[model samples]
Target: MEAVVERFLKYIKCDTKSDEETGVTPSTPGQMEFAKKLAEELKNIGMSNVSLDENGYVMAEVPSNTDKNVPVIGFIAHMDTAPDMSGKNVNPKIVENYDGNDIVLNKDQNIVLKVKDFPEIKECVGKTIITTDGTTLLGADDKAGVAEIITAVDYLIKNPSIEHGTVKIAFTPDEEIGCGADHFDVEKFNADFAYTIDGGSVGELECENFNAAGAVVSIKGRNVHPGSAKDKMINSMLIANEFIFMLPDTETPSHTEGYEGFYHITSLKGDVEETKIHYIIRDFDKQKFEERKYIMSAIVQSLNKKYGEDTVSVEIKDQYYNMKEKIQPVKHIVDTAFRAMEECEVVPKVVPIRGGTDGARLSYMGLPTPNLFTGGYNFHGRYEFIPTFAMEKAVDVILKIIELYTKA
Candidate 1:
């Protein structure tokens, strides 16, 4: 739909970038503003039971046209853009009939999205592409997914002749901070199985994701005089550095890819007296994931043994686990997504997610959820771009999944 592109452009202009430091659910007030607009748009498209929560979760339903006992399916996407890039005043440029050449994102900044850097741009061929202007993220990471889902639901509502089961849709906030499903009322939404349309590229259907956790390593030191008392003064910052070095440097996010796990140092700050190192650990394998956390705590324990017992404290909190454990029991849900892609002539790229999704947490919350593609590329960055043709295909994939479910 031409309206989908227009809607995406309007949505990105809302400046819905999430704040990691904020304790609030949506994190930014702009997210709430965008959520409200999306809810209104969902209602306008004639979705049933359209509602928004106080915490900024929007859910709507498209009732089944068929009289069969088919399972109610849900589609989900996050509302907030990544905080790593600016979402403020995102000026989207439409590249019609993508010529497969390097297009300048900003002539003033000398920013060019090169074909050499991203050869995948060649895949779009003659398709329309929406990209940022080098100043802000395009917000297509999940907004494109969101727009695709809503557009599909709208299509289903308009064409009542297309026999399908009940469809549920949800728009969530704070997914960038990894708490998208923290306040999600899954039971209230009431779908047997759901799919989060948050994948990076087209043909993506990821049921397995990283088993994740966050670690806060606090290093305490005795700061006497650095010049006069050498033995009495302990540099906490140096100890923090030492602690970071204990983990395998090769396992960092920058170094690792695919299913390989990493101990990513997210933030580091300290002085001579006190220092803190924040880390996020990720692994796809359950046993390996546990071992990674255990190894981290052991490193801290060893440091504490050398120093005082409480000198180095490691506080590790489990964020979310791989959805493979939860989705394995309901394997057919994954198959449904797979067949949906194939039926739409989109090859199924069933890969393990290197990162976590709201679906990962929702699966553990008693819903077997997987992820689908929205045709976004170079997400959460200024170079972020999306193929409009791929997004239009996403709409087909969603409806196809619903059709496959009912037929099965």
Candidate 2:
């Protein structure tokens, strides 16, 4: 069997960084290249109906070996890494039998993964852990997920004696920028239910995620000579800063957790001529989510009233909503995951996702897709790492879910 760790190490080297500015599906050429490679891999692994679509969505089917009819299940993961960090030229370091000490990721650069900052590293004791060299993200956000699903399917195909039902697998692109399901052909995929193997840590099963939206504030200001700019000049950069400050300071991502919603400022860039601030609004409550958008719009209006009419323009677009509503109607799907986790001896962590996932959007698209873990931590950053054992365990969980589904 191909090791999940080996697959992850190889997949992360592809430099599949998604670009939000791009209009095309997959967003970047690297994603398309990666998808093609993965599609070929699926075919080589004996998966049927293996296809890499124009949008870089790779879908494959694992034919059922059982005689009785069983519901088709799908497992999904994203191919693109977050735009927040560079996924290029990644150099991974392995720590064997981690002793729970501070790991120095780059000795020359003196970059260390401090235990104090990330105490969770202690949990991976006596296991092989993979980490970045402090120069780039590990891309474990969903690559680990990709590896786990593939490894599990490979195991199923190799062990045809282990009775199982039809299983579908999908690898999506541009999930980080919130367009993963925008072009998803759920009807064609033909799954009764699905799970996105894209969560953090082991044994995480998430059905609830944030109700999300994006707010873009465009600030236009007049640049004048500092010598006589007192009343004549309007500093749009300052106005942008004020617009951000107008939002409640305590309601930001850093200040909230565990069912608490947040207003995350993703980017702020500008000069006096023009400034654009990008923010993502999230909430678990539908009403609160709407209120948050209202607050953002009200702030933009107040800034416009202060600066001048049309000086500050704001655009708020609704992203994915909480999947709880969709998943609740099919709660047994979550139950099956919990049972599968127990069978795998993985203590299930049923938590609400603070951020959204491709599964959340897919759930609303008529697929009650929950989320599973990749056994990774500190995702989308330099400190990102994953335990080899945890990743192997994820493969086991996937297999267990397939087995449990056949019994059902």
Every candidate's CA RMSD: 1.7, 0.9
Q: lDDT at 329 for candidate 2?
A: 88
**Model 1 agreement with the true structure over 61-172: per-residue lDDT tens digits:** 9988888999999999999999888999889999999888998999999999999999999998898899989999999978898888888888888888899998999999
Residue-by-residue lDDT tens digits, candidate 2, 344-380: 8999999999998998999989999999999999988
Off by over 4 Å in 2: none
Cα-lDDT of candidate 1: 0.90
Worst 10 residues of 1 by lDDT: 2-11
Clashing pairs in 1: none
In candidate 1, stretches whose alpha carbon ends up further than 4 angstroms from where it belongs are 224-226
- Candidate whose TM-score is highest: 2
lDDT to native, each model: 0.90, 0.93
